[model samples]
Target chain A: MSDKPKILILDDEEDLLATYKDLLTNLPSKPEIYTTTNGARAVAMLDAEQFSLLITDLHMPEIDGFQVLAIVRRRFPELKILAISSVLEEQYRARAYSLGVDMCWQKPGTENEIKMFFDCIESLLEERPSEGFRGIQNKSLVDLIQLECICRNSTTLKVISGGIEGKIYILDGEIIDAEFGNLTGDIAFKKLISLKKGSFEYLPAVTERERKIFSSTDGLLLDAAQTIDETTAEDKSEVPDASETGDRTALVKPVIAMSKIDGVDFILIGELKSPQPSDSWGVDDSKNLHKWISNTVQLWRSFGDKFLCGELKDIFLYGHHCKVVLKTKENKLLCAGFKATVNNETIPNLMKDVIALWV
Target chain B: MGLTKAKKDQSIKLIITKPGSFTVDANGNILSSTLPLSVPDKFIEIIIHNVLETFLTARASGLIFEEVIIQFIGLKIVAREMRGGALIHLTPLKP
Candidate 1:
């Protein structure tokens, strides 16, 4: 009913909320301004009241800014949407446009951009149309997170918060790397990844060239990080016994390698012994032993599919009455017998020696 | 007592005579035996452990062990002819 247009601003930052409120309050028409620190609360307000313009920041706890846009487009089609962020990247901008964002404003060096955004909003409010594609918002930190998640992308996400820059690498939705200005990798990830409840500011406008470089380098890092995260998560979730955990972790590499083996891969361990004349009770005994060996080989071959390569031609197993051997397509040779065993005490120790060869 | 003991002594004695060595390739192929006469027990254990460990670690590290093998040696030794040995094969798990 008031002559002034009503505007709602949503962001998780209290300071930004106040700043925007102060900015809007000083305007000529004295627009009615409403602010909240979360997208969910903002939606609640929207459900209760009608507003001429809606401004939102992308990153926030619980519901994110994009989800807010999606909701507005679906439920409140008539509302003019303006997206604001400090970290504006290309992919995010593209997404914002697809979601029907009217104006995208980058926070830094963009005071005038905000003013122009309002001007466009005023013009659009005067003549509402059926449907039109609005300008895309700049890429926000939230946008980057979403993009990474959707692509199952792995990389270090650097965010400038307060006066410090924080970096976190997400691999397969698991946080594997994090650094708050100084620390990085495992230590950082351990410290910060769990602090999901805190609020932080981020700069959104990274250069295009820098973004491209980041995507390439961070991509590989992210993939590795994801693998670690997944393993760690599995370890934690399953709460496997220490020995089992050790066994499982050890298998990770071999499984991946076995999957990658071109045709067939074989591994053998233990000493082989022939049946003594006194031990050979009858011919049926040898046949039984062969059957057992065959069964074990079949079981081992079944696991080959779980490896990274997933295709194996054949595996030839040979061993004394108590020995075992496996052969693959790449090369044929005996590995890790008496000399290696005497050198190491435990199975893990011997395995470590074996793995060292590949590394 | 003498008659019972003598009768019990008539049972046949079982002796293992197989001779082999434990061997493992880098491809995670594990072969272990206790029948071969030439392979050593320590080498066989190492081979078995290495093969299983290779599989486990590979799963953990996201890498692969191409092949592994282990052979066992079984032979009777009166005084000293029991020098045991094992052969190891290792390669990358390449696609």
Candidate 2:
């Protein structure tokens, strides 16, 4: 955040932009002022330079104010946004707030309305909230692109996270091109926007950045979300699909989440009645594994009772093939099979961490 | 894990690990018993078979059971491989 307030005015009309610039100079704060008639230029300026306040016109050419607001709102958390529109519709105002706009107003027409507009700006520039901000700050990159395309932004964006960098071009509210590493078109867009975390910077659109992606922004987002969800579900290793395990989902969730981490090869919930595992992670369709777990429990329970071990809690089986931790709860046996590569000393703590949440 | 000679010497107090015990053969047949079990030999044999048979079956499937520790609310059973049989011990769990 800048020490002194910096305000940027974005309007399609150069005359209105000039008037706002001249009027804001009267404020006692003497904040730096920037004006741009091009919405793309305004977004690039906001990204390149840190500005404390952004005053944008909702109805603009090339790119509208709502797109600019969505783009900058998350990228710059501390910055305040004020939206002005010629056709002050109720839905547009609502849309602006949803996009993280702090305040929205009709463009000044009457002298009294003009005076009030200037007064609101002066107060907004001067006042700082002691409490935290209200609007949602964690919008996904896919959402940002959707908003950009919705407003028909003819701009380019460079998305980056960790070692991966991708470029997406939205021409008139449609994804025309995308490039990530060697991948291109819709595949590149899906892979790029599907990234879990990243920062996006505005870029000037190239005239010849070929139309690689034919799908609309909405289609692309849906495709990307679906693609990513399937990959995540597979990575989680739920044999029966955790989403479909309606009744046992609550207990199955934590186990599903912990799969493949800490060398846990497979996790299983063995219902004494079911021949197969009720819910499993990283486990194949094997009935013998489930039977082995049930038999192991029965044997351990009998030993614990006969030898005065009392109410059976859990059993740890260490072997040459693999290590197994079995926890008996009611009629269900919560089981985890470990990879041989995992150190034996750390298996107990790791098992507890994996099953601790619900079991 | 085993204690070193230094640790053994530092641990001067006597520790009674076995409160009661029994032994089972590789086929899960009761070999001997020291702690008079309330359950009959048939129930004991049934349990031993249920557990060790499964253990052997798992071993055949490339998952051999070297040692198994069964924890309970008030006691613990640590079974270690002895020859082809199992050496089972019972001890009260310290709160």
Candidate 3:
């Protein structure tokens, strides 16, 4: 076997692919390099041969960079993935990170960009994991497992956190099953993934096991992300906000005056009605706040609740930029917009005072 | 006249619902769903619980409503109230 490390380059652009291959070939390491224009073909090559590193572009046609990253993440957890993209959008970069890519480089096609790219590649190659039970710090366990799947390493991941212990069974880079107490499959997997302060030890795969969950690796990641998001949404409702400090002493604040909660922004008071008619509430013209709320109520009513009362009690929505806490009085709908940091406990009381004063 | 419908893809991708506890007894807590497996039950429970709480809070406050659309970074959720429970749809806008 050749002593040189093997490298794979995947890009749709033939010229760039060849150029990258040439650059890596001349490095002092003198690595054995391969190039492919098709993402699918590159994946096939990955399965057929052992590659020390993978450098792929993000915008390929048939099988894009993200797809390739997801597949490699599942089947080849040991293989380090480097993503190159001409479109350096934050959303794309974040997605790549979540999928377990080691590094993302924006391909500017300049000499300096090429030089920095090569330097990055050299650094990553020098720092590749070679020993058993290597210490990886400051990464989410979920991300780490995704990395293991990408490396295609069959290993037992043991996680210890706060007097709790769990074991995850990954066979041939697929998370065959996991165990934490009586939980198994996805339940156990999610518990392990949600450990924020845990230490993990990875031992080489031992006993073979039957697959208990058939979802793809990306599916697993997606489920984990959703689970975390929902947990955060729930937690936000219980957690006290820093802003809850100074605002509690006052009791006689006017309805219009009560609109400004420390972390909350715009406040709209309108009658609960359909969108067009809700325009009469006219809280703001810059944005149809009343119309949106009315439409929202309309959507809520369509869920087959034939006996829905004429009033909706409260609706708290957390979206991009703003979070809203909405309440309904006898004839008025109160929509209070707040930042994510608004204290959950203060919402009901705050809305109550505003409704008592106004309605 | 009888109503007709167009043929569409039958694959059930995602399911969203209000939690089972608040629903009338025996309707079985699932206010809505389209997924095949009952797996990820906890995740489903958490989501539905929050949705149900929001609607119940609205009902208690006497706000008569139809639907709610919530937008997150990569997700758009629509929850509509129905006869016995609510229907929720989760759509991922990005990866």
lDDT by candidate, in order shown: 0.47, 0.72, 0.63
- For A127-196, candidate 3 gives per-residue lDDT tens digits of 7554222246446777788888998888998876544667888877888888887788889888877655
lDDT of 2 at B16: 25
User: C-alpha displacement of A55 in model 2, angstroms?
Assistant: 52
* Model 1 lDDT on a 0 to 1 scale: 0.47
Which candidate do you rate higher for TM-score, 1 or 2?
A: 2
List, residue by residue over A84-128, the lDDT tens digit for candidate 1: 778989888888877767777666456677787656656655554
lDDT of 2 at B12: 30
Q: Give per-residue CA lDDT, model 2, range B1-95, as digits (tens).
A: 14553443333321224366688887677778776645456544654665566567777665787888777766566677777788777565642
TM-score of chain B of each: 0.33, 0.58, 0.59
Q: Kindly give the stretch of ten consecutive residues in candidate 3 chain A with the minimal lDDT sum.
A: A277-286
Q: How well is candidate 3 docked (DockQ)?
A: 0.02
**Best-matching candidate per TM-score:** 2
Where model 3 places Cα greater than 4 Å from the true spot, the runs are A131-359, B1-95
Using lDDT, give the best candidate's number.
2
lDDT of 1 at A246: 60
User: What is the number of residue pairs that collide in model 2?
Assistant: 2
DockQ of each: 0.02, 0.27, 0.02
